[model samples]
Target: MPLTAAVLLRSAALSDQEFLDALYLSTRDDLQALAADPALRPMIAPMIAMQQKAQGLSYQASYPGAEYLVIEHAGAPVGRAVVHADADGLRLVDLSVLPQARGQGCAGSTLVQLQQRAAEGGCELHLTVRLANTGARRLYERLGFDVVSDDGLDARMRWRP
Candidate 1:
């Protein structure tokens, strides 16, 4: 959101699980709405944990060598990014910033850094964003990523140096 947010990435550690879990929940507005219902509130915690685990497992299965990094601002963890670099290119398996840290340029700055890495290595940067996530798709387009293909649910985008 701002020019001086100082967002950076560091390897995520096992000890960061609590923070990571909270961050994951923060990104799920659907879950938040559901949890607001009295009947659903009781199911929120377990659901979050289950979904987080499933997501981790899916990413690991799909991107075997992905780097799991914590997105930091002024040395504080504000988000997480999972990236996989291969001979084809660098794929951003996942990226999410906490609600409090959104609109402060954390995610954008992180993507720029990833673009730099991709440029240095002469490879394309790749990612898939949910079709429902128009905000993120717009941001990626602003950073010069082009939509290469799309299914009904998600769109595959690419940025080449």
Candidate 2:
């Protein structure tokens, strides 16, 4: 049977560390693809390392001031999105869907959830995407995010509430 759209967007709890770690590691290929650029390689390497380390800790201990939402479908965690408040707005710090779940609207649905949370807090939404990640950029664009600044390797996108 095909997966349904009843995706549960729940705040990731401490026990979800293993699941988050698995999700993070599963994105290695995607990350390596982005790291192919020499300019982005240096910046992304350290950040990736930091993320890996953080994934080792309990979610509650590591993600303070951030809302980490796990997207569950068919009773399994398939994606994750993190949002935090910034002076500009509610910034999306990270968002990823498993390779197998990419085209199933998981990412878009997760974004809708994040946007709803931001709306409840009366804040706009913002995020940055690598210039080479056309798929992600397109998704953000489709969700009403506009390029606010071009930082060569990445573009800072914003959605005003």
Candidate 2 per-residue lDDT, tens place, 42-139, comes to 78757776878766364446446878789897788998887777676788878888888888888887788778877888889988899999999998
List TM-score per model, in order.
0.93, 0.76
- Overall lDDT per candidate, in order of appearance: 0.93, 0.81
Query: Residue 24 deviation, candidate 2, in Å?
Result: 1.0
lDDT by residue for model 1 (29-101), tens: 8999998899999999999999998998998888997999999998899999999998889999999999888
Sliding window of 10 residues with minimal summed lDDT for model 1? 1-10
The window of 10 residues in a row where model 2 has the poorest summed lDDT is: 55-64
RMSD of 1: 1.4
Q: Which residue runs of candidate 1 sit more than 4 Å off their true CA positions?
A: none
